[model samples]
Target: MGRQGLMAGYEDLVKKILRIRPELSEEDLERKVEEKLRSSPMLSRLGALLLLADELGALEVSDGSALPFDLSGFTKVSSLVSGLNDVSLSVRVIAVSPLVRLDGRAVLRMKVGDETGKASAVAWEQKAEELATVGLSPGMVITLLHAYTRSGPDGRPEIHLGKNSSVEVVEDTGTLPGVESFFVPISKVSTAGTFDVKGTLLMLSEPMPIQTKSGTVNVVEALLADEDGEAVLVAWRDKVDLLTGTLPGTELMLTDVRFRGGRFQTTVRTCVAKVARERHELSRLMAGSKRLVSDKLLRVLDVVKQPELVTLVVSDGVWVYRLPSRSMVGVEVKEGDAVRLVKGFVSERDGRKAIMTPEFGIKVVTGEDARKAPSVDRRRRLADISEEESDIIVEGVLQTKTPLGAVETRFGKAEKISFWLRDGEATVLCSAWRSKAREIDSMPVGKRVQLRWVRVRRNVFGELEVLVEKDTKVVVLEK
Candidate 1:
């Protein structure tokens, strides 16, 4: 090399060192570079300068810039040069594409990035199949060894892995920056594109089946929030499994999501993982005066039945509480019946107090104890029912009943029955699900029954239907 070119490289390195450590004068940096060269003979002037910069912590900031030497043996994403072979990198996976066949051969693509910048990467043949088998997802830190670089379809530098290359999940992720650092805060998301977000899962809805032109697909709606604000997120198909057991207050990291209709939806490239969880003890959540006292004898006021659970509105005479359970169907208690609640605590739900229990911890009160329980009956006329009102009580004769049939719901297969309720000139349809279907199916037509706390809604036919839910109480009045 020409002496002038070598001198220029040394001068540039000295200037970089001076910028980071202004205390080190140009002469001092030259002396350090000479000392490094003296200690390690065979090192060129530029190589010695690079070593000195590493010792001074200046090389770390050489992002997106070409370095004379790679002491760490890993190349930065932004510093990648096309046609370079055996290049190694440590980066976090931001997105991944499904393995596809190109010319009848398998190829997998991924978007990876480091703190420096982002880049596209691909694996072909055996490597692509291996990566697919490893379940590569967003937010995972991986190291690629012996990979080669080439121009991508967009005429930009891209990393490619072949038979000689290797990929492994980094065991110690602390060496690299956290995945959340690359996230665009939830509130600032406005454009429709692939983006990563970090926030707390404030709310999660039950997975529902939606009919599409292709087929029925399962989807879950969730509200994610950060300190700035909240936004909606929808998980579709296989991505719904990522949120299956997660609850509100869980910290989440979502990657490769697409924003549309003012909401973020999980795409084929999207991946979700829980970052952290806020633990709340049951006793701490139920610490209030209106809380339910465990093992207390309570009077049943109403019952609501749904496909997944049953809710009973019970009262301790002074305070009312809603108790819901999936196993409560086994208990055959009705309104005015007294039951002892065991191992249950009161917690606020839907802005109302409720009794939370792991199972049906109810024991029926009988003999003299039942007579001491409080009793109350409230009723609403069927003709006065409106779609806006909920938890309405009404009495009518079962004019027509449908045979019990099994139907598949999100909660699983359950029995269902629809019946026509007639009161004077007013007639309405009522549908019971799960255990309530069996209860209603046993009752003969033309019997007078009172349904308390039933929900009113219009069916698809635009006809008013009284919906019996987990908390609706069905009482048959035999005269």
Candidate 2:
């Protein structure tokens, strides 16, 4: 065959082989070529060029650039150069795995020093895996072989190491260069909203459960006062289990605090708590301060085992009702059973205040002696006067009702149901969401039922609507 025809035939074979196994690396393709050449010695040069093309893969090559080495050298050297990089300069030593996912493919990352400054060099996936095995430790010098530049994720140029690239690690016996370390003072570390602040533990509270996205979360919230005043630190879940019953004044450290409701709170998932004896430098910076109000004292109302909903009359003559769920479980307290709740912030529903339970220390003082508060008279009558003002109790028959099963909520899953009910006064439309919904749905619609903890809200059409939540309970009455 003529030279052009021979070359064309060899290219066709290379394309066919690549199509069969696109994932084949340079060494893999060369192995196949060696086997073919052994069978037909006359086709050795054509096999060599095809092997080189397979190794190069899709990477672009400069014009007139010769192949780095023969097939044997390409395979052996490619294995040796597990990772490769060619950058203007080297910078700080940052771990590379987090930067990219190579799936066992050779990868490399290096900071190369340049005339202007230092920059990062990144090799992705298969190319990265190949370079990784060559021991590209920090401060190691390497020579770039058949390395080329390509655009990276951030739209900037980065090194792309192919089979032709070369890398090496050499020992440096001279005095090591000083590495710069960064530090932030506690005061300067601004936690604008909720954030995690790690410092010496200045004070701690008893272990308690706080409602969170993951259901009931056991937690111990304490004051982590450093040189920059004090911050609320919460140890969640297992951390709470470990820190509970710890000494009050013992030093503690916390991580992964979340700032919410104008205070820092941590959950079982993101928080870590520990007790220590020595004060940290941040704590020293926090010295010489007057006694600030303790978080325990501020959050006292959270721990009180009250019903899911509690009503308090504020000094402004507005009644504020605090509702409990998986969210407001643990808090510290301070004052009165009937103290007025000051309006701080209102929740999504215009009526409830967003004040921390511990902030008011208020208690249920009026109904202390009554074992059974006349729910039918107080709650039901209010429901009758204005459906929007109702907090009703009912004993009625639930007719054939459509059940609303589990509903997805930001907090978690909740079940709901809609039912028609006949009380002495009138037939009403009622709906239950969450646990209560499941309970009501389980009862026979024709059976007599008693419902407690029901709240009435006006729908968009100005009709009274009963909104039943998880805390609402349904009892099947004896006919």
Candidate 3:
């Protein structure tokens, strides 16, 4: 703007040119400065000086990004700045965000963190294109050699990788200090950065078609979780397909998903998801060993025994589960017996919510035999315990029998017999103790039997109860 300001800018440029080409003598410098000033007509004196020096080949530029990042004598990210010496850094590739392009230049963004601190890394042009060829991913450890730092717009430290600089894959990083993740646990998820999440599909609500500003989108609500915590995931339009294909207790991973509007969810834009074909950790949950209690567990309020399907009711909800073979599940269930449906699919029929499961994914806990027994329904015979009466009076047909011989007992080592019986409605297990084992030398299956005043108790493994003591009347009602 003023003659004095113009002179100051030009003087600064002359000094920079001299620093790069110190061989230039005083006379040569004076002549170069005069020629540059006369040939360029930029308002800023420094602008004209730089323009002339560049065109006249008087300025020397470093071949940046031409050397591999060298870790030799490297330093920490928190220790470098814009004008500081270039140094190498070791960081975890927390996330690789979407690439940005402007004016024909490409820049790839990466959220990198290390034991000491976290920073953003930018790769320009060619370096950005080769990012995929380098096979980088989140949770991976990387080493950036000969890298430099600069203050970002927000005035925070940022890493800049040039042509010569490189990010080499090292190993997967351990838990980073003071660092969060794109694939953080459900409990730790927040509305902050672009991220991913992995969890089991606990429950999926019916897809509700809503009219949005974008268009009509089929929005499906889902509950997701791992061993740690849970979050509600909502999928719109194309992502709605995930609901039908997924099952309860399914292991899955969602990519490019986010947390917004107080919800942990994402649509299928650049986002993707992968699901385990078969149920994983389903047994642990059904057996009550590994419980994700809050929403993962379904408390059975009642059970209905169908020919090949079992309908379970919980509170105000109901599930119609198809059984491949009720044989494996011991179809006999009662009210209050907790049922963990691993791969149940929720659907709607006649405006009512219905659920189904694959034959192999079914597991049940019977109220009568469970270690944690609920009130059994005695009004209905053993076959139907939806009433939850554990009154212990059961008259059923003898289904099978096997002698578990020579079990040590209070009356010395005596014979033990295990048998299954069904009261035309449900099946149960019974054991004949020591002397009572003699009453029926060998139980004739297919015969109707009755036991009076038998003591019922849950066994060690929370399975069948052993009855038929010396005082108990073991009568063969029909053979």
Q: Give the TM-score of candidate 1.
A: 0.43
CA lDDT, every model vs. true structure: 0.72, 0.45, 0.55
Alpha carbon lDDT at 372, candidate 1 = 79
**Candidate 1: where is the Cα deviation over 4 Å?**
1-165, 168-178, 181-197, 200-225, 228-251, 254-300, 303-378, 403-417, 433-442, 470-475
For 1-479, candidate 2 gives per-residue lDDT tens digits of 23354467665555555554578765677676687556534234454545455455521443343333232222221122223332222222212222234464544555432222323355656556655554344344333435556654434455555654434322232222321111122234455443334455444444445555567765545555555555455456655554556653454433334555334555422323333455455346345434322221111111225333232212222332332322223433222323322212222232333232332333332444222222113336322535464334666778668857777788677667788777665777788876567677777768878765566778787777777644445667865
What TM-score does prediction 3 earn? 0.34
Q: RMSD in angstroms, all models? A: 12.2, 17.1, 21.6
Q: Which parts of model 2 have CA positions greater than 4 angstroms off?
A: 1-194, 197-235, 246-255, 260-264, 268-378, 382-400, 411-414, 422-428, 446-448, 456-464
TM-score of every model? 0.43, 0.36, 0.34
Deviation in Å, model 3, residue 477 alpha carbon: 68
Q: Write the per-residue lDDT of candidate 1 for residues 213-319, one digit (tens) a residue.
A: 46678776666666566676778987788787786567777766887656788876565656665454222323422323566778988666655556688777665
Worst 10 residues of 3 by lDDT: 316-325
Task: Arrange candidates, best TM-score first.
Answer: 1, 2, 3
Candidate 3 regions exceeding 4 Å error are: 1-88, 95-110, 119-124, 145-165, 171-184, 188-222, 235-262, 266-479
The lDDT leader among the candidates is 1
